[model samples]
Target: MLAGDGKPKHILEVNGLRKTFGGLTAVENLDLRLEYGELRCIIGPNGCGKTTLFNLITGNLKPTAGRVIFEGREITAWPVPEISRLGIYRKFQVPSVFEGLTVYENMRIPYFARMKPSILGRSSVSRNEHQEIMELLERVNLAGQAGELAGNLAHGQKQWLEIGMVLASRPRLMLLDEPTAGMTIAETKITADLVQEISESSNISVMVIEHDLGFVKEVARKITVMYKGSIFREGTYEEIQADKDIHDIYLGRHR
Candidate 1:
């Protein structure tokens, strides 16, 4: 696909994405694409293999058969860390912040540690990197609690911290799964706004998998509805929300 400028429309493209555990298939021959700097959402019912597809894309798990191309490069089955270092970061369904460390400490670890060369074990974080981390905490509204242990943060706050950690990688594409999963109404709204801001300010594409339709509607410019291990529909928020076929399949009303 190409935009009006005749440039490639998407930065990441997945063709024939599939995953199987023995004879059980989780994702089956799925195909989808994400444009640069686009905020897209994937929504589906439990056991629909949304996470499975994410893991495949991020190289946390290998696809049984597929091609994952990013920026005109083939990345199928690349190791997770290599894929991450290549500017792809995935936020898990559960918050993965370091529980024992303070918010500041958690963010700094990845910020500094990731800079170290894997083989040489050299680390370098400029003073500006340190300053930016503080700014990030403030932006996330957790600067006051930067001294508090990450284990003590509320569910939503931890979600924010995990997001901060992913930012430390300076990724071009971020895959966030259920970012507002355990948040309250207020926190959910706040998290959604933060994602919108990050996608805008960072100029990075973000593909989020969220169950809350209202939240997805708020954060996403485009929506990809998936079910039975395949795409059901793709469109703008209003288009998909009003799509009776999407609703029918999601509601068990589609055959």
Candidate 2:
């Protein structure tokens, strides 16, 4: 739907999106479309507007101009909560949750949404919710610490909890940024498996922004390469890794 104005749309669409800040351009005339349940990755060098693009998508920052359509609705400039309520949940690079709350307590929190209200969500979900939560925890290998305080958990556990919190809301699209930051190789592999399970287990679309080529290649089905606030190229993981221009761009030869 188009906010208050009722309408349906393709899962997600960004047509000619543009964002400019005074002297600097963050995202310029960008066009992006997401199919239902597709796992898409976004990669770029520093200052290439990756986060800015995310901000625009999550309503953290408004684009200078563009049309943002989600599930057949217009949310180009919608606020965070509104966008979230519309089933587009987002996760940050850093973990977010009630540190003081135990894992059980954290999962017991209330649910918030404008549509499809399930009195029991991830925290306090019933059989289905509980099953999903348990599966997610186990999938990420965090079941052993389900009763521990969210703060008492390890760094990787904390990250998993934040992901669990987002799961509690049952979002249709997940925006993940550097989910494996500071993690070891084994941990990163585990997390990647969990992400894969999530994709295989549901119809949720994932738009991941990550820097590690190996990591992205592990989970990404398609990759969108960004530079200078616009898309440099989009292709398969192998295509991006072997791209001549990408190498030049990384070698400081592309301007």
| Candidate closest to the true structure, highest TM-score | 1
TM-scores of the candidates in the order shown: 0.92, 0.87
Give the Å shift of residue 184 in candidate 2: 1.0
* TM-score of predicted structure 1: 0.92
Q: Residue 107 deviation, candidate 2, in Å?
A: 2.8
Q: What is the lDDT of residue 114 in candidate 1?
A: 63
Q: Candidate 2: misplaced stretches above 4 Å? A: 1-9, 110-132
Compared with the true structure, the alpha-carbon lDDT of candidate 2 equals: 0.79
Tell me the deviation in Å of residue 32 in model 1. Answer: 1.0
Candidate 1 wrongly placed segments (more than 4 Å):
1-8, 117-126
Error of 1 at 58 (Å): 0.9
Return the top candidate by lDDT.
1
Scored by CA lDDT, what does every candidate get?
Answer: 0.87, 0.79
Minimal lDDT window, size 10, model 1: 116-125
